[model samples]
Target: ARRVVATLSIGKRSHFATARVAMEAYAKRVGAEFVVVDSTAHASLARWNATLHSGSNSHFMKLPMLQWFLEHYDQLLFLDDDVLVSPFAPDLFSSVPCEAFGAVYEGYHKQGWHSMHARSFCSLYGLA
Candidate 1:
């Protein structure tokens, strides 16, 4: 299966630069292609910046990036530029089923959904 590890890097500088070396090594270990989308010059960025009040520009950019990746890849592992993967981490592609979407739900706790962040995220995608 075609698999890719992708991240979006926007703004004046590349946030992915610091973690690129390590992330590329991890992607190689996991047998996936590594890609970075530098969208600082994208036309949609200015519009998104002006209109979006709920999420940051980078977060909104992920929606289109995800759509593009899904069209070209059988599986994709989308990580924030700031995330560094451990060399010893397992191959996540093998763990998830082909037809299902996988994500780490950090907004939930023992008391149930506890933050506005989670609610806003769900509402953003109409999952609420």
Candidate 2:
């Protein structure tokens, strides 16, 4: 057995079934369970607001992974739709070991297109 089980959250049932099926097929080949956390745009977003406000506005529509985050996931990953996973995913979860962690991305934006607005309109000049 290569892995125990890899868990990830899904915004909806049919959002990425094709890719999910491919992943499920691979995981089955290696004896693993792919847990899909069914989530929503409304409920999850509301929860995100309740838990965190202010800077949360920066991320816009994408549902933050905290809603469907599975604590048991040894190396819990907050993923988005555009991710590409290869069949040879060896050492996928070898390095991470922390209560909370995220890579320091060097200028990358992954979401809908929107124009940058004037900070004078936003509180704290949105320096947050």
Candidate 3:
């Protein structure tokens, strides 16, 4: 069984602080190890790898933090602060495919790919 840890980054914003509190409660309820990355304090550490093109996008910092978690954990669940974990949410670590990265599709488009949003555009233009 792969040991899993949950992680989230919190900026200096107030909303993010509230989100962190919620995430911490969720982590406690699920009996999972929770890691909080302080974007305001350790922003420089995340820039060690120039290839990632981290820029001002604090979300990119998760890359280095994820790597660090990988060293100590078998798998990592990187959740955004904005996400609200439901009590009914399934155990994700057990469902993740072996040797493959897993992510949920936001399902913004029900028809063709043409209706996809900015993320699709970034993928197409190689900017993401």
Best by lDDT: 1
Write the candidate numbers in order of decreasing lDDT: 1, 3, 2
TM-score (all chains, Cα) for each model: 0.64, 0.41, 0.57
lDDT of 2 by residue, 45-111 (tens): 5555555556545354343544334433444444443233345555333544445565536466555
Question: For each predicted model, how many residue pairs clash, with residues at least 3 apart or on different chains?
Answer: 0, 0, 0
lDDT to native, each model = 0.70, 0.43, 0.58
When 2 and 3 are scored with lDDT, the better candidate is: 3
Which clashing pairs does model 1 show? none
lDDT of 3 by residue, 67-91 (tens): 7667666766778755555445677
Model 3 bad stretches (over 4 Å): 1-4, 40-59, 107-128
Ranking by TM-score: 1, 3, 2
lDDT of 1 by residue, 4-112 (tens): 9987776655435546766797789989999877664454244455446655545565676577778779999988876656556799999996678999855535664
In candidate 1, what residue range of length 10 has the lowest lDDT sum? Answer: 112-121
Which regions of candidate 1 deviate over 4 angstroms? Answer: 13-15, 40-59, 107-128
